[model samples]
Target: MIGQVKKMIKQCFFSQNNIKYVDYKDLDLIKKFLNPHARIMSRKKTAVGARSQRQLAEAIKRARFMGLLPYLSR
Candidate 1:
């Protein structure tokens, strides 16, 4: 009960860490936002707000374009 409430009150990673921008060079971090199909995860599912979600998507796309992240999985 207490754990659930504490978890609910905690904010998302970016907000909690005060990260203003997502870095395209951080493929290890950005890859977490992508699914097995190489699709960006939805805000509802990822528990991120609209702004963060958009930034995350852009970072992922940039990483993919730069060949840092994979376009598809085997």
Candidate 2:
């Protein structure tokens, strides 16, 4: 274990809440992944896995299409 650096793992929101699906209608949850400028956060920033990040992006897009979320924020 010499010179082996330990990486800290951050827990994902879905896993913590025991959520199975990413829902577009859940504005609160979706907002958490979006930045103040209304853009989706990166995986590194959100600390979410690849699959969850994809799902989150899809949900955000769907929400915006349905007029639930804003495309841009002031």
Candidate 3:
């Protein structure tokens, strides 16, 4: 169920340019899809588990309310 939700969110937010924003609610949905024990072990990985988790939190803050497009633009 969570995987499906995550896939939907990814398809909705990451795949489309028109979707410039995501909310905390949306982030929560994504968090539900994450594995708690996952760990990041890289310096140049796109989405390295735990590190990506942290990045996701920050990204959610930037994407939510305001939007992700501007940040991606930079």
Please name the candidate that would achieve the greatest TM-score relative to the true structure. Answer: 2
lDDT: the better of candidates 1 and 3: 1
lDDT of 2 by residue, 1-74 (tens): 86798888788877787777899999998999998899999988878877888888999999999999999999
lDDT of each: 0.81, 0.90, 0.40
Model 3: lDDT equals 0.40
- Give stretches of model 3 more than 4 Å off: 1-48, 67-74
How many pairs of residues collide in each model? 0, 0, 0
Model 1 over residues 1-74: C-alpha lDDT tens digits? 77666535535677877878999997777878789988888777777777888899899989889988878886
TM-score of each: 0.77, 0.83, 0.26
How well is each residue in 1-74 modelled by candidate 3, as lDDT tens digits? Answer: 77666442223222243434334456554444334433222323333344344555555555444642222221
Each candidate: RMSD to true structure? 3.3, 2.7, 12.9
Candidate 1: give the clashing pairs.
none
Clashing pairs in 3: none
- Which scores greater on TM-score, model 1 or model 3? 1
True lDDT of residue 32, candidate 3: 40
